[model samples]
Target: MKQIVIIMIIASMLLFTSAAATILPPPDLETQGILLTTDVSALGIFSNNADLSWRHSSEVLDANLNLVDIVWDPETGLPVVDPETGELIEIWELQPEPPLKYDSASFEVQMATVYSEDTSAQYGEIAYSKNSMVDTKALPASMSNVENDRIITYTGLNGNRILSKENLMLSGAGTPGVPSALSTTCAQCIPPGCTCYPAFCSFVDTGSKIDMSIVSATTSGEVRNLNKIGGGDGERWPPIPSVDGPAHMSYSIRVAELSSSQPSVGYVSTYLNLENSEAGAWCVGIPSLMQELSINERKSVDGYVSLFSNLVNYESAICR
Candidate 1:
């Protein structure tokens, strides 16, 4: 019961994505004294009710958090900045649950969406925000970086549309990561094909984390802090290039706090759904309102994050 209580508290922190659109509340971004980022702020969730919605914050990368390692130009003795694109040659990090293998060309849309290049400033330092991450949302931070020998993957999580205690996959309960609902794939990863299309988004998870220092984007414009994940207890991962040729994208719920047993992470769409519904949340995270409808009128990761930027840039009240 104590553990469950702790998980629920953390859940409420990230309950914002599941917030009902009915009564648009003011920015409840800050909980307790923690100044949360736009991405991880607890917008809304039900009172004492478990969110059955299979959400995932699997793919969005927080610029503040993901500014992993700086890429230096040995010749210039300074950070490398793309002259034309203006993208800084820095290793921006990511936190996909199962760990989306890195790809350069394929992730172009995601790169262009979340990251921008503004070489106007020297050293390519662009202003961005910072956020906090708990390797273990349920247990204390001291428990982080420890060995977690549980279920290795969340490949079969789409069975139940409405989550209950029975179906809950706990850390050491059945899965490798905690916040069991926080799956590896963002959307309906059904079977053999196991495609997470229509809503392809993911973010960072717990356990292996990058340095939380580089919280500023060098290229300028508006570097988005995306790809926040949940279900702590993984390996200690290093900073990977933010724009690797193109890249990979996943989605999950922005865990207000990491937990060992509760469902902390979720779908990027569900994570972005701060405005009541999926489409509305999509509107919050995309680049523009104009939608390039996919198979079932679903939006792309690029579109998803732009709307999110809108929340941060234009609609400050909701996030700030």
Candidate 2:
């Protein structure tokens, strides 16, 4: 009877241990991804000769962060008990997680404008302020060689200057019949029927400004999942990983002629290109306005009235 009772107790204890093991589930392992979008808009104004006009522009951006790999804690999810130490000995450790991947990331900018007068009647020009890029991971550092090796120079009608990759300049000559300053060296050399105007419309040199923001994933999807998995021995589990911070890109334009025109619109766009991939994002900022002005004939008589509409389009691409 004593031996039978002892055997029964041992069997009950074994059954209980087996049930506890079954209740403890394996560590959860599911991959996840992140998506983000941002948008902004503003109003601008251009005025001259007591005439005022307003314009509007807007921008939008989108980004996607995907998981590519994960690394598991060495002792968190292991099987086997050590008889000597009375502790669970780790038999196999999970492999290290792969690097985080960025996919389907893109940014776009669109703009529209309205004016009280026809701006196209007069000669006008549009140009980008500058170009800029920012990344938290210093990824641009790897492409410095490619960027530094290339330089673009632009020669305008009156003079030449380095043009920003983000900006486009489209300008027209002065009034067709009006003599330009470049036509002759003498200020009085104007023909009997010709009146001299500046070589180009002084209003053609307006500049633009832009501002932008963005966010991206820096860790693998598997690592992000570890934070949700609760049960792990304090000694074997690793600290939870944190998410990456947002990145920023911005630029501005400044010209002497358009110095007084207040810029109400700031737009920024960006994209993350995968390794050996050709994917990229397209961005554009366009400002439109109309101006009504009276041209003086012979510098005295009221000349024919004309309306001008100016549409300036700035475009660029982002690839990472």
> Each prediction's Cα lDDT score?
0.21, 0.18
Q: 89-150 in candidate 1: lDDT tens per residue?
A: 67865554333333321111121122111111112112322232222122221221112111
Candidate 2 deviant stretches above 4 angstroms: 1-247, 257-320
Off by over 4 Å in 1: 1-190, 197-233, 236-320
lDDT for residue 313 in candidate 2, whole number 0-100: 19
Local accuracy of candidate 2 as per-residue lDDT tens digits, 1-320: 11110000000001111000000011123222322222211122211111222111011112222333343346875445566876655433333322111112211111111111111101112221111221111122112100101111111232211212122111111111122232222333234322311111111112221121110101000000011111222232221111111011111222111112221111212111111111111111111111222211110101111111112211111101
Question: Per-prediction count of colliding residue pairs?
Answer: 72, 17
Measured by lDDT, the strongest candidate is 1
TM-scores for all candidates: the values are 0.17, 0.16
